[model samples]
Target: MTIRSSWSRAELGAFGEQVAVDHLQAAGFQIVCRNWRCRYGELDIVATDPASRTVVFVEVKTRSGDGFGGVAEAVTRDKLRRLRRLASLWLAGQDRGWAGVRIDVIGVRVGNSPAPELTHVVGVG
Candidate 1:
């Protein structure tokens, strides 16, 4: 595999988002959208959990190393607050209704192994 350090931040994030998407799909979630953006911010991935019939808003953080902090730590309470608002905005634009809504965080760490490492925190909101 190519070295993670060689990739730019955008590239790394894009790769990580793809990884997160694949992981979610494998875990039985139906992907609704990826990289949903608005004036306030962006939602990395949006999915529907078939079992729960809920809309899932995902935030993905990608890092080559823990120089700053763990990938999950990149998302703070303030960030989650903003995410809730963003999720509302996204939900407003949707035509279908969900049983409930949830916010999740997926952290991707690369460069140390042959494949990327992912951590999923469900119902963070």
Candidate 2:
């Protein structure tokens, strides 16, 4: 986990997405896409859990400090609703279907520390 002292919002967000992807792959999830976007919104990460045969939609929030409250506060109900709708739209374009679907959120906190912190919440909303 290399931590930089400074980062722009886009850089931080992209770095966080990569960190989230690494975490998910380590947990045995197969990554399907990153930054999947449509007319509705964006899905940070799309993956499949072979063990559960489920499709997972991930939203990543990267923060440099405590400015944003926490996981829940970072992802609001309206955001979750938009994610749900986005997930459905993404699924519609897929050629295959899964037995289940889930929403996950990964929060990446990067500051002047040596390493960034990560919080992964599964099945959000």
Candidate 3:
């Protein structure tokens, strides 16, 4: 059976982020913040991987359809550069030190099914 969603675009994006958070937690990431923003841009999800002791800045791209392209396709070189800058800003604001920093991208494809398709591209930046 298929599950239909009546959520608006923003709602869909929020839902996707929630799904991403859940997936990340299950994979052993401790979520630090969500929707962290600055004058530059926004970081969709900030997480810490205990095993790697690394701070991960995540960019989430959520789409209800694939007419344009895969959700990951939306992350361009410019976007990656922006993410890097945002990550630096985030670190500068922190009081303590991080083991390391990495950038990741989460692509969420929401469809008629209740379970959205998710792809995690680690260390994209």
Compute each candidate's TM-score over C-alphas: 0.93, 0.96, 0.92
Worst 10 residues of 3 by lDDT: 1-10
Cα displacement (angstroms), candidate 3, residue 76, comes to 0.4
Candidate 1 wrongly placed segments (more than 4 Å): 1-5
Show where candidate 2 strays beyond 4 Å. none
RMSD, each candidate, Å? 1.4, 1.1, 2.1
Which numbered prediction scores highest in lDDT against the true structure?
Answer: 2
Candidate 2, residues 1-125, lDDT tens digits: the string is 57778788888888988999999999999999988888888899999999989999999999899877877799888999999999999999999989999999999888846777899998997
Please, what are the lDDT tens digits per residue for candidate 1 over residues 1-125? 34455897889889988899999999999999898899999998999998989899999998898896885678898999999999999999988999999999999899888889889999888
Which runs in model 3 stand beyond 4 Å of their true positions?
1-3
Q: Which 10-residue window in model 1 sums to the lowest lDDT?
A: 1-10
Query: Which of the two, 1 or 3, has more lDDT?
Result: 1
Q: Rate the local accuracy (lDDT) of all candidates.
A: 0.89, 0.90, 0.87
Q: Which candidate is the best by TM-score?
A: 2
Q: What does the lDDT come to for candidate 2?
A: 0.90
